[model samples]
Target: MKASDEFQAPGLDLFSFPPLWPGAPYWLTKPTLMAVVGAVLICVLMWAAFAKPKLVPRGLQNIAELGYVFIREHAARPFLGKDADSWMGLLLSIFFLTWIWNLMGVLPFVQLPVSSFLAFPAVIAFSVYVIKIYVGVREQGARDYVGNLIPRGLPKVAYVLLVPLELLQNFVTSLFTHMLRLAANMFAGHLILAFFSAVGFWFLFERPTLLGVPVGVLGVVMAIVMTGFEMFIQFLQAYLFVLLTAMFIGASLNPKH
Candidate 1:
């Protein structure tokens, strides 16, 4: 479809969306590919940096070390406590993995951000949720962990009413919501960007000069503005995912009542 014939952006039209190929596999979509590539790249980069442990770290090792220290001392330790060392490896892996995937969205050629897909972000969130639940149960025992929803000072009758509600509402729902929130935000943001970008392009190049060019220019302006917004959102979403995961870990560690 020509870009400027209609006022609406063609990119956002579900019926006329671009296909990567005639019939790509579910796992081979642009977003999925970007995520996979980003993950592999991060792994190789880390291995290259730290393979030869050095007394005087330089190059990538030095940069990687600084990152590790930040997450270990600041992110994991505060929430997971002294035992954070045990889980620090996992947290660092996830943090860098997430950061790289989000970073890929803006990079040329690998413009697709995997986390923008609901499936990808959902998988990550679910993984963190499972680990959080496992930690809580393992440390506190299932019974105690389950009992933690209700406060300690509640009366006996209140416990009967509140415990189930707390468990049903906060603990259970938060996990799902955490994943959905990230997925939804990324998904919507990416789509909006696509729409506006397409509209801007169509207006600039396809339609008649007087009408199409001016509208397209406006569209391009909006796209630039949104692109800036997307960059900010990308970082914020990554931060929220990791931060919430850590907070959940903290909650699980201390099963109250």
Candidate 2:
């Protein structure tokens, strides 16, 4: 038989998961379960870390505190400043939950990132959008909130162009990009990893030949390298998502005139 007959490349089907059980609903797929698991894991970790205060933190508490401090300083404080502590709970959850969602893509038997599904990131981004608008309106008043979208000091005629542009950017573009950024990264990363892994599996195991062996080895090597790189990207995406959230909230609270 031809080697080509035995080897098949992975495709978009890699991202499409079936229900976990025979009778499960369409929504109860691997990604959905993993998302719920990620949320629960975050809650458990937070409870374990903070439920019992300790003067000298150790083990899980120490590790969790390190993550907390990292988000506060890098994600929250730099953007939210004085209000950082007040929003730590939300910021910390967003950072850790997002990280876990992305990390799921690498785990054995559960190689699907929840955020790879557009719905997951969309919901989170939409929530942040609603919160931003609410806070902006509350802090700046309805009139000022809308007015602040376009900065002053332009030619009077500029408002004709800038007004609509600013409105579209602030309301429509920001929300879509915020969600799509994270989802697109995760989706593309998972697809690349799957392709390389499929190549390695097919060439090495399913259709092993003298000529195919070297290609299989190359595929395996690339998969390993890409996995490490993808892991870094996963963490970076999580950090950026939270960072942008903090920035949006900060901007709402303190609009630049």
Candidate 3:
């Protein structure tokens, strides 16, 4: 088979198809397209939801209200306490943006989720980390915040080993894990979907013998199952990301627990 013929596979070929730009702006990439589309969609949805400004909320207002309530009550309240009212909008933004980006990866023509990239998640994580540290220092003062790491009643000898571990785990390691958790989940899930989808086509078109048909059917079944699974993971990873952010912020603001 020619190189072109060999390159032809199911999900693999989907990405192999020419990008919107061959040698131009980076924004023209597939993942960027998804991110842009997700952002636009959210903006439109927000506008529709709030444009009328109904008291009872008939259409989009209802959805907007529900989202507001969910983040406020379920996510922010439990983590950030009564003070979370100030951070509600920020938390909501991250929650929905993460969700939309995850869902965007599954869409046709824009199969990549930018959140799957470390740069995107890192940006978010770093921002949140900065906010957390800022609030921590501001609320407790740098002395108190740093002091909180040492257990209130720990022996002087134990401080030698425990202090570094506590600081590393709570302050440093957390940021890395929080960011990578979202990015890795999306990246791995999308890649698996692509692989399975490509293999399915390879089975059907490249090898059409009696054995190939059943295998192709199996591949298709796997692809469908994986896609459904990815959708769930996408939402879950987004929620987890937001939830962790809330938790971290909560810890920084109130680390007594």
Candidate 4:
């Protein structure tokens, strides 16, 4: 059989899902359900971890505290400094929720990363964008907030070019990039995993042959390797998203910085 005929790699259709139930709305698809599940899971886990406080933490509390401290120290404190503790709740939610969303891709029977749906990441990014603008305006005042986008010491002639560019970068490009970065990474990672998994299944079970066995083994091995790497990417993207968020809020609060 022809190679193309033997194995058709997964495509964009892999990301598409019908409604979760018959007669359900088009929007009630797998990604939407998984997104909700992820959010609920985070809430439940948080409650389990912190619903009752302990003087010396153990089990879930210990794990949750570690995550809290990690976000506070790594993602928030560096950017927001003294204000970091005030923002820990927001930062922690963003980090864990995003990581869970990305993590859903590897889960059995629920292997769809919610962030792969642009709408999910877009919502978070837009929310942060609004908060950033609001905090900047509130903390720095409207005029100063806008003025802060333009660096202070540029030559007057430089303002002609720098102002528009800085404005665009701060207002438009940053928002879109923030949304796209998370969505694009999860989308591509899911596709890659699907492709490798499909290859292994196709070659091994669907069309087993002496020549195809090695290729199938390679596919399985690569899928395993990619799964590990993808998990790291999932966590890293979550961290980066929260880090950028803290940076945006920090910049708003300290425009000169």
What are the lDDT scores of the predictions, listed in order? 0.74, 0.93, 0.82, 0.93
lDDT of 1 by residue, 135-217 (tens): 88999898878777568876789878877878876667887787777767766776777777777766676554776787778
Candidate 3's residue-wise lDDT over 133-244, tens digit each?
Answer: 9999999999899888678676889989998998898789989999999988887888788777877888788766687788878888999999999999998888889889
- Best of the candidates, TM-score: 4
Clashing pairs in 3: 11-198
- Model 2 lDDT per residue over 1-257, tens place: 87668767777887788899999998898888889999999999999989996999999999989999999999888888899999999988999999999999998988999998999999999999999999999999999999987889989998999999999999999999999999999999999998899899888988899999999999999999999999999999999999999999998988888
Ranking of candidates on TM-score, top first: 4, 2, 3, 1
**Residue pairs in candidate 4 whose N, alpha carbon or C atoms collide under 3 angstroms:** none
Model 2, 218: alpha-carbon shift in Å? 0.6
Which scores higher on TM-score, 1 or 2? 2
135, model 1: CA deviation in Å?
1.9
What is candidate 4's lDDT per residue for 1-257, written digit by digit as tens? 67766578889998879998999999998888889999999999999999997999999999999999999989898889899999999999999999999999899898888998999999999999999999999999999999878888768999999999999999999999999999999999999999999889988998889999888989999999999999999999999999999999999988773
Error of 4 at 252 (Å): 0.4
